[model samples]
Target: MKRELKVTSDGSKTLYMENWDECYHSVHGALNESMHVFIKNGLNEVEADSLHILEFGFGTGLNALLTLSERGGRSIQYTALEKYPLSEEEWNAVAYGRTSEERVAFASIHLADWNAPVEIESGFVLKKVETGFEEVEFEPNSVDLIYYDAFAPSAQPELWTTELFTKCFQTLKPGGFLVTYCAKGQVKRNMKEVGFEVMALPGPPMKREMTKATKPSNV
Candidate 1:
C-alpha cells in the first residue's frame, strides 16, 4: 500500500492510502476529527476517576496522543490493537503535538513495546497489542470505553459487522460506550442488535454524523 502525506483543512497532516483510497484521519482536519470524535464525544462523556480504554485501530496514534493530553488527571489504561503497525517514517509524518509534553508523549506512544504494558507517563499506562482485534479475546465487561476508529465500512466491511460490534458490547463495562466517526445506518443497527444504545451525533468538519454506542449500566 502506497502512503502519501497530505495536509488537512486545519493544516494538520494525514496519511492517504492509495490502495484503499482512505485516509488515516479525516481530510477535513486530522486534529479536529480526533478531538471531536474521540475526545469530545467519547472520552469526555464518561465520568470516571480511572479509565480502561480500548482502541480498535492504532493507526497514526493521534487518538492516543490526544487522550493522554486531555485525560484531566484521571488514571488511564489505554490498550490499542493494531494489525499492521506503522513504520517510524509513517508515524512521524503526521503533524501533531505542538507543545513539548505532547511531542514527548506522541513519540512514546509510537516507541512503546508491543504485547506488553508500558507506562508512557504518570497515571497513563499504554499497552500496544500487535494483533487484529478479532483474534484477541478481551475479558468481558472490563473495558470502560472503546475508540472504534477502524477504517470505513466500505474499505473493510467485515470490521463493521454485527459479530464485531457484539464483541465490543461484550467487552465494555456496564455504562461504558464505544465512539467512532462512523454513522452508517447498518452499523448503528448492528450495534443495537448487540444491545448497545446508539446515538447519532453531529460529525466533525467533513462529516455529517458520527456514532456513539453505549452499553447500559443495568445490563
Candidate 2:
C-alpha cells in the first residue's frame, strides 16, 4: 500500500492510502475529527474518575495524543491495538504537538514499549499491543471506553462484523461506550445485535454522522 501525506482543512496532516482510497483521519480536518469523535463524544461522555480505554487501530496516534493532552489530572490507562504499526517516518510526518514539551510528549507516545504498560506522564499510561483483533484475549469487562478508529467498512469489512462487535461488547465494562466515525446501517445493526445500544451523532467536518454504541449498565 502506497501512503501519501496530505494536509487537512485544519492544517493537520493525514495519511492517504492509495490502495484503499481512504484517509487515516478525516480529510476535512484530521485533528478536528479526532477531537470531536473520540475525545468530546466518547471520553467526555464518560464520568469515570479514571479511565481504561481500548483503542482499535492506533493508526497515527492522533486520538491518543489528543486524549493525553486533554487529561485533567485524571488517571488514564490506554490500550491501543495495531496489527500494522506505522514506521517512524510515517508518524513523524504528522504535526500534532506545537511546543517543545508537547512535542516531547507526542514522541514518547510512539516510543513507549509495546505489550506492557508504561507511564507516559503523571496521569497517562499506555499499552501498545501489536496483534490482530482476533488473536488477542481481552479480559472480560475490563475496558471503560473504546475508540474504534479502524479503516472504513469499505476498506476493511472484517473489523466491522457482528462477531467482532460482540467481542468488543464483552470486553467493555457495564456502561462503557464505543465511538467510531462510521455510521453505515449494517454497522449499527451489527452493534445492536451484539447487545450494544447504538446511537448516531453529528460527525466531524465533511461528515454527516458518526456512531457511538454503549453496553447496558444493568447487563
Candidate 3:
C-alpha cells in the first residue's frame, strides 16, 4: 500500500493511495471538504455544551483537527475508529494544520494512546480506537453525532448496506445526526429503512449532494 502526500485545492494536504486510487480526503480541497461537510454542516447543527462524536474513518485526523479549531466553548469527546492505523511518518507527512496551535493539536490527536481517552486540549478529549467498522459494537444511543467518512460505495459496497446503517441508527441517540460525504440513492434509502429521517444537502467542491440523516427526537 503505497501512499503519497498531495496538496489539495484549499492548500491543505491529503494522503493518496496509489494502488487503490483513493484519497484520504477530497482533492478539490481537503480543508474545504472537511470544514464544509463535517464541521459547518455536521458539527454546527448539534446544539450541545458537550458533544460525543463518533467518526468512522479516522484517516489523516483532518476532521478531528478541524473540530478542535471550531469547538469554541463546547466540551467535545471525539472517538475515532481506524483499523489500519497510520504510522508516525505517514501522519506526519500529511501536514493538515497551519498555525502553531493547530499543528500541535494535530500531533496530540495522533500520538494519544489507542483505546484511551486523552484530553488533547482544555475543551477537547480524543480517543483513537483501533478496530474495523464492522467488528466493533457501541452502546445503543451513545453517540451525539457521527462523521461517516467511509470510502465511497464504489470502493466498499459492503459498508453501505442496511445492516451497517441499522447499526449506525441504533448507536445514535434521539435527535442525533449522521453526516456523510456520500449521497447515493441506495445509501439514503438504506438510512430511511433503518428509521432515520434523511435529508439531502449541498455537497462540497465538485460534488452535487451530501446526506444528513437524523434519528428523530421522538424516537
Candidate 4:
C-alpha cells in the first residue's frame, strides 16, 4: 500500500489511500454536508425503530460517528465497506479534534475488529468490511440507507459506473435511499439507468449539487 495518508488542506482531516481526497468532516464545517445527506435525507425517513445502514466508503468514520451521536432511541445496524482501511493512528489524529462525544464514538468504531460485528453502543451495531468495492457482498434488498462516499468519478471511475449503481440497486430495500455529494450528469444518468429514482439537491458549500437516489417499491 502507498503512504498516501496525510492531513488535507483543511488540516483537521486525513486523506487516505483510496485516491480519495477530503476530510471525514468538512474542515470548513463539520455538520454541514453530513446533516444535508445522511440525517435529513437518509435517516429521517426510516420508520423502523431499528435500521440497517450501508456506507460504501467509510472514510474517516465521520458519518458513522455523527449518526450515532445525533440519533437516539433507534437501533442502527451499520455495515461499512472500505477497500483500503485507515489505521488507528490515522483515525485518532483526525478524530480527536471532534466533539468529545463523537470522539468517544469514533474511537469505538476504529478499535473494533474489521469484518466482524461489533456493538458500538446500546442501540448501534457496526460491522466494517475490508474488501474491494466489486467484491464486497450484501443481501439483495437488505440495506435501508447507503452513504455513497466514494471518490469522485474523475479519480476513481470504476466506482461511479452503471454496474456499481446496479449493485447498489440490488442491495437496497424498496424506499431505501442512497445519498452522495456527487451530482454529475453522468452519475445521475447512470443511477437512473440502474432503476433508481434520482433526485438532484443542493450540495455543501463550494459544490453546486448533490444526489439522492431511492429504490422504487416495485423493484
Candidate 2 wrongly placed segments (more than 4 Å): none
Off by over 4 Å in 1: none
lDDT of 4 by residue, 1-219 (tens): 443445443445545444355334444444567667777777776777888999988877878887787677899999999887877767766654356777777888888999999999998999999987889767998998899988778778899999999999999999888999888899999999989999998887666788999999877
Report the lDDT tens digits of candidate 3 across residue range 1-219.
688889888888888877667888999999889999999999999989998999999988999999999988899999999987888999998876879989988998889999999999997999989998998899999999999998788888888889999899999999999999999999999999999999999999998989999999898
Q: Could you list the CA RMSD of all candidates, in the order they appear? A: 0.9, 1.0, 1.0, 2.6
Q: Considering every candidate listed, which one attains the maximal lDDT?
A: 1
Question: In model 2, what is the error at residue 45, expressed in angstroms?
Answer: 1.0
Structural similarity to truth (TM-score) of each candidate:
0.98, 0.97, 0.97, 0.89
lDDT of 4 at 148: 91
lDDT ranking from best to worst?
1, 2, 3, 4
lDDT of 2: 0.92
Model 3 lowest lDDT segment of ten: 12-21
RMSD of 1: 0.9
What stretches of model 4 exceed 4 Å from their correct place? Answer: 1-12, 16-31, 96-98
lDDT of 1: 0.93
Two-way TM-score contest, 3 vs 4, winner = 3
Please write out the lDDT profile of model 1 over residues 100-219, one tens digit for every residue: 889888999999999999999999999999998789899999999999999999998989989999999999999999999999999999999989999999999979999999999998
